[model samples]
Each structure stands twice: as C-alpha cells, then as structure tokens.
Target: MSQGVSPAAARGLKYRALRALFRHFGRMRPAARLRLGRWLGALAYRCVRPRVKVARRNLELCFPQMSEARREALLREHFHALAQSVVDRGVLWYAPPEKVREMVALSGYEHLQRQLDAGQSCILLAPHFIGLDAAASRLTMQCPSGATMYAPQSDPAVDAIVREGRTRFNDVHLVSRRDGVRSLLRHIRAARPIYYLPDMDLGRKGAVFVPFFGVPAATMPSTAQIARTWQLPVLPVLSHWDAATGRYHIEVLPPLEDFPGEQDAEAATARLNALLEQWVLRMPAQYYWVHRRFKTRPAGQPKLY
Candidate 1:
C-alpha cells in the first residue's frame, strides 16, 4: 500500500524529480561525471561572466599596480580553476582511492608522523584548493585514527553521498560544528587529531577577525584555542596542486611553538592568518573568491555585502 503524500511532500518529490533528471543526464556513463564536469567548467566560464568580472575587481583592488590585462587573465584562470574544482567533486565522490592517489603529490608527511609518534594530536589546517579533498581522503586512509570536521548538508541524499566518500578511506570521525567548543576540545584531549578549514568568515563568536591578504577576514579561533589549552602542536598544512608540475605538494609548516603565550589571542590568530595569506597568494587562482570574505564589516563601517 502506498502512503498518501502531503502537499509539501509532493512539492519535494517534484523538486527531487527534476534534480534526479539532471543527475542522471550528467552521470550516465562511468566517465560521464568527469566529462560533464569539464564541460560544465567551460560553460560556466562562458555564460556566467559576472562572477569572473567581480573576481577581476577583487584582484585589481588587491593588486593595484598590475595592468588591467593581467588582472583579466587572473580572473579567467581563477574561474576556470574554480569550475574544475566544482566538477572534480564528482570524481572525488566516486573515483577509486588508487585513481585519486595519482592526482595528488604530497610532500610533508613526516611532521604528521612525528606528532603521532609522540602520542600527541595535531590539527591540519587547509584552505580551499583543488587537491584538498583528495588530501583529506588520503590522510584518513593512511591515518585511521585521524578525525575531521564535517558540515551537515541540507539535502539528506547529497549529505549521505558526501559522508560515504569522505569516510571510505577509513572511519575518520566527522565532528559537527554544532557541538560548539566541547566536541573539538574532547578530540584534542584524546589525541585523536582533527582537521579543519581555518580560513573564511565564520562569525565573531567562534572566530576572530584578522588580516588575511591585507584585508580583514574572520578566522576560526578553535585551532589556536585547542593548541594553547591542550598544549597540542599546531601544524600549518596546505595542499597545492601545481599544474606546471602536474602534481600536488602537501607542505607541513613547522609547529607554531611560540603561540599565544607572548601575545594575545587575536595576535596569535593574526599570525596564522598571515601564513594562510602567503599560501593563497602563492596560488591566487586556487583560492575561493566566491566567498564574500569581506562581508562581515567592522562595527562602524558599512556592509560590503
């Protein structure tokens, strides 16, 4: 017997039906996802021109001395890279571990090993990059005990798909941001090691506004707090995908041995932000520009958003 569907349920069914139609079209063959992604990337670059224009404006604002043509080139490159990242999600979710491994070229695994060997946990902070998802999946496979944060999705079906891919490497514990302070602190105390995205504006509560790329970008304070409170080593980790070399370089910066003790909390956060800025500047196109990074303006200022 079929259950009667409510009006809301019927509407949801219609929406899902449309979404599934597209998904079926985009994911027909085994390689369809990859092919569709490349096509979508190119299409997005052509049709959605405003986003790229804004990115150009951002680059110009940040680098005033650069010529207009150079900024346009950066904008085009950034849009294409971002589109590739979007399309790559299909591969990240469905590709086999062996296939995924070939795409990344990791450089620093020794720092992570040293921390674990000492019976201590470390936080791996990686910003937005193409190889980031691959690195996280790879890390979990290599380090079973390692845990990372997961942002719950609005769509239950998509959430399930994401969770399945992320956890397939190993049973990497996925902590929810809703757990507030307790969840992260608990993981640190147990030496279970967690990964987090430290960049972006997460608001004033869990974050402290700091100078990122010479502009104020809100940064998560959880990393520094846990490191100081639990006395855990803070390792700055970034995975860069070099197209020229056709490999991924995962670098682990030296542990922030002199953190927060000599300075205030905000200052320590600023130091980390500075380091992240350097990494992003190295590969500007890889960084996420869609993020309204300067949205949360200071109290007396006008809203940028």
Candidate 2:
C-alpha cells in the first residue's frame, strides 16, 4: 500500500545516524551540550541561509507591520534557536532522568492536575518549541500513561532514535498521524490524556480553513471536533528555553471550558487559533515560522509555498 523510502525518509535516516553519534559523544554536561548546540546551530544557519532567507521573506509578508530590520533580526535568532534545538537532543535522550528533570522545570502542574481532577481528559495542544521533546519526556515522567503523536521519520534508523528519545517513560505512547485519529478517539474514551501539535498544515482533506494572524489557513478540524463531541477540555501548553533560568519552563495554561457554542465549528476554531497566537507571540523566535502557514489559503488565493 505504500512506496518504499522517499527522499525525505533517506535523509531522515542519515540525520538520525548523525544525531545518534552526536548524542553518544556530546551528552556529558548539560551546559556544554547547549553551548555545542549553539555552535552547531550557527553552522546550520549558514548552510541554510538561502532557505532561511526565503522563509524570512514569507514572515515579512505575513507580518507587514514589522520593519525589515526587525524581521531579519528575528529570522537570524530563530535559526540560531533552531540549531540549538537539534544539539539538545543529545541531552534529552541520553542524560539521566534526574538530570533531564533538572533541566526542565514544570511551572503549571497544579493547573494540569486540577483539570484532571475534574474528571475530564485534557488534550494538551503544545506548540513546536525549543526542547519540545525534552519537555514532553519530562512531563511523561510525571504523567506516565499519557500519549502523544509524531510524524514518522522516513528513515527507520531515525524513527527508532526518535522513538527512543520520546518514549523514555515506561507507559508513554507515540501514535503516528496515519493511525492517530482512531487511536486518539479510543484514548479520549478511556479518559487518557493525549498531546498533539495542530499548528502545521495537515494537507487539505477534512480540514477547516480559519483565520490565523489575519490570514485564512487550513486547520485540522479533528481536534476541535473531538473536543466538541467528547466535551474534553482543551489546554494550551508551551515549553520554552528560559535564557534567564537556563532551563526549560513548561507553562500549562487555563482550560478552554467556555468556548461558547459546541456546534459552531468555525467560531470555536477561531478562538483556538487566537489562544495559540497568544502562546506563539510569547516566544515568536521559537515558533516554527518557516512553515507555510498560509499554504492552504482560503478560496481564490494562490498557494504561498
């Protein structure tokens, strides 16, 4: 039913091998690993400067109010942060659990616990922030039975590595997008908390176009649909690298219990996107700006990608 090994898959394999090798060697000290991540990220930023430049152009188009100088600064910082994200994988996957926990501080556990105490399973809608997996892994240490979804890597080697990095806790699960819908429903029915990043464009099928930052973008309606059908409380979660604290901080926002109409899909989705924007704006540099958010534009618009 599937063709073997797309180029993305092959590249993913090579990427995984390189990452594993790096993790094996560079995971001794948390501080040193992050410093190394900065250097490696700088190098990556240079190699992909042209692509990054194009992405910056897109950001400029999307955020017209920002000056070119300020936009450029944001782009450069974003790339450096992106690079650091890559190097930190070593620390996330290989470091001992206590050390990993030390590097990530949970600020809003009481909030999450209170939501759970209300007998409603939470759908943690986390964005792709710096050290995201590390934060996910740390969170799992506290909430062991929770599940998360990830896009499968093209390379088997890379998939294996990612799985190892993600499923460090005993009872955590990784559901690929292809098989995620059914799995998510089952998890919800069982009152198991699940995590998903619904920010990216998941193609055009079965999606609802909604306004994101004044632009109509295609959003996966499945999340909202599930929330409406099951009456599950959707919570916005963000894990960011705190330069001042020199550790990751996980922010668990208040639950969206009052999203008004349960049947008005468009308005509900718009509210969710607005909530997402609040978190994204807090650390615009860490958000995945290079993604063509306007790719699946509203009716009559050309594809921005």
Candidate 3:
C-alpha cells in the first residue's frame, strides 16, 4: 500500500506526467503523432462541452449565413485543427531543428527579405491562427533577428516550455505583454521585425470599435499608429495546416503600400480587420475561433460569449 499524496504534490505529479507524455509523443513519426492528435481532439470535442459551445457560438456569430449542419461541421473540424496544433507543440519544442523544418513549407518569404535587405523596418501582421506557433518556429530559423510579444501563461512550468521552444531557433526578443507597447517599439526602432498579432479584443483602452465579420469588435489600433510613427512597412503573414499534405504553410505577403499615410488609427484598424476577414474565409476551420473574439461588446450592446 502507498501513502496518499498531498493536493499540491498531486498537482505537481500530474503536470510531470503530462510533460512526459508530450515528450513521448514528440518522438513519434509526424504522421502518426498528428493522427493521434486528431483522435485526442475528437475526444476533447465530446468531453469539453463548454469550449465546444464557445466555438459553435463564434461560428454562429461570424458566419450567420451558414446553416446549422454546416456550422457544426466547421466547429468539429476547428476542434481537430486546434488539437493537432496543441499536441504538435511537443514536436516543435523537443524535435531536432531539421525535423521541424521538414514539417513546414514557406512561400513569399522574399517579400519580407526584400524590405529587410534594404535596411527598412517592417512589421509582420500575424493574426491568431491554430498553427501560429509552428509558423513562429519556422520564422525564427530563417529570419536573422526578430521580436514578438506573448501573454505569459499562469503555470510557470508551461510558460518556461513555451519560451524555450519559441526562442530556441533564433535570437528573438520576447517581450512580455505586461511591459506594454513601449518595450515593443524600442525593438522595432532598433530595426527588428516585430511579429505582431493585431486582431484581438483587449478592451477599449487603445482600441477602437471596428467591423469584424460585420460585427462591432474592439480592435487594437497600434499597428497603424506604429506604422505611421516609425514609417515602417506592414506585411501580412498567414499560416495554416494543409490536411491533404500533412504539413504547415507560412506565407509572407507583399507589404501594404501607402498604409496609414494620412488615415487615422481607427481607419487603419478597419482596413486591418478587412484583411484578416479575407484570410479567415480562406480557411475557416484553421482560424482561432475558440477565442472569445467578441467578448468586449460596445456600450449599450449585449455581451457575446
């Protein structure tokens, strides 16, 4: 017979167990691991009813014209994509650099390189997507140096893993979200390409209510402000997993010309939303729909989960 462990000790043991499982899964073949991940996602779909509901509600709000059956199918696919991305974190963190490189195919990277080569500052406007971490990993390998912000995870163990995996490939300046935009600007002014995720509701502080999928969404206007203030070029970067090929694709599109030249921050933010809308439509299931995008509603408007 064994003595029962204390609650804190039990929690620590559980975390270690999960970490070991991730390492084991990371050693498996890519195809096999992804298949297992999809299965896990299916299990999560059945068990995590609250998150499933959130995904369904997001779909309903964003794609109002979509039929119930169609929306449900999209939600199921989204969960599977989300699961695969989450589980693949192990491979991204522990697998060899060559192995990680093999799993991604990049395109339009020259668009970014050209700007960097000319000694011009540029911002990679990356929206929230399921395969974002994979994309970031691949990016750190190819780019010389860069900067990005992250909201720190509550669990110290998990946070450490995330930081190590992201910065392992290249010399990246990881700024904490708590430090605010001032820290990010210092790096940007130093000619570091900032991988900015500009499409989220962080309340009304520095954000403006803009039309996202035809609904009023609180969006950050910092992208436009930064571009105008520093005369930096804005390039849109999108990443998605190709189910048919079982690989991730990262695309760096051409820079937006004449952006934020005479327009105010609010107008620039609206334009940013329109660009993100196009990308979301291209791969509806791969976008990060589980997030509460419409969490902060306009005053006098009812809240949306």
Tell me, by TM-score, which candidate is best. 3
Q: What is the alpha-carbon RMSD of candidate 1 to the true structure? A: 5.4
* Model 2 misplaced regions, further than 4 Å: 1-22, 49-51, 115-119
Question: Lowest summed lDDT over 10 consecutive residues: which window, candidate 1?
Answer: 1-10
Q: Write the per-residue lDDT of candidate 1 for residues 1-305, one digit (tens) a residue.
A: 11123345345654456445444542444345445545666687688877655566567656678788887777666666666555554444455555556655566678888888887888787777656776776677677576777787786555555565567665577777777656776667677767877766767665677877676766777767776777777777777755443345667666767765667678888988777767878887777775667767666867654
Q: How good is model 3 by TM-score?
A: 0.93
For each candidate in turn, the TM-score is 0.82, 0.88, 0.93
Q: Candidate 3: list runs displaced more than 4 Å.
A: 1-19
Q: Best-fitting candidate, measured by lDDT?
A: 3
What RMSD does model 3 have? 5.3
In candidate 1, how many clashes are counted? 1
Candidate 1 — which residues are off by over 4 angstroms?
Answer: 1-38, 48-57, 244-246
Which residue pairs collide, candidate 2?
Answer: 9-154
Each prediction's Cα lDDT score? 0.66, 0.71, 0.83
lDDT of 2: 0.71
Error (Å) of candidate 2 at residue 278 is 1.9
- lDDT tens per residue, model 2, 225-252: 7777787777777888865445777877
